[model samples]
Target: MADSNDSQPGAPVPCAACRGTGQVISNLGGSPSQVPCPWCEGSGTQIPGHDAQAARRAAAA
Candidate 1:
């Protein structure tokens, strides 16, 4: 039997911060710029210790 915890092994879910784009908008100094997502470290996947619920809420905002 396959593991129940993971629907697809070796296939991680997309990063909530970057929305799988591996980048996010940086508004530093009142200027908008694209930067690698710090949460996933630019891998575009959900990493351990990432708070999915909070990320979703932040994305919604």
Candidate 2:
């Protein structure tokens, strides 16, 4: 059985960190600012073996 969530091989998947926006909100110093998504490196696509949670933590820092 194939899962619908599975994407075709080599297809670009929307980044989990940026939600395809290629950016993330950083609330550093109590101000919300937009920064390039660390997970996708601003490409808005998921990289194989990329850790979304680690990127999220880095973005929040």
Please give each candidate's TM-score.
0.63, 0.67
lDDT, residue 33, candidate 1 = 99
Could you tell me the TM-score of candidate 2?
0.67
Candidate No. with top TM-score? 2
Worst 10 residues of 1 by lDDT: 50-59
lDDT of 1 by residue, 1-61 (tens): 8567767667698987799999999897799999878788788988988665685577769
Per-residue lDDT for 1-61 in model 2, tens only?
A: 7687776778888998789999999897899999888889899988889876886687579
Go through the candidates in order and give the clash count of each.
0, 0
RMSD vs true structure, all candidates = 7.2, 5.4
Pairs in steric clash, model 2: none
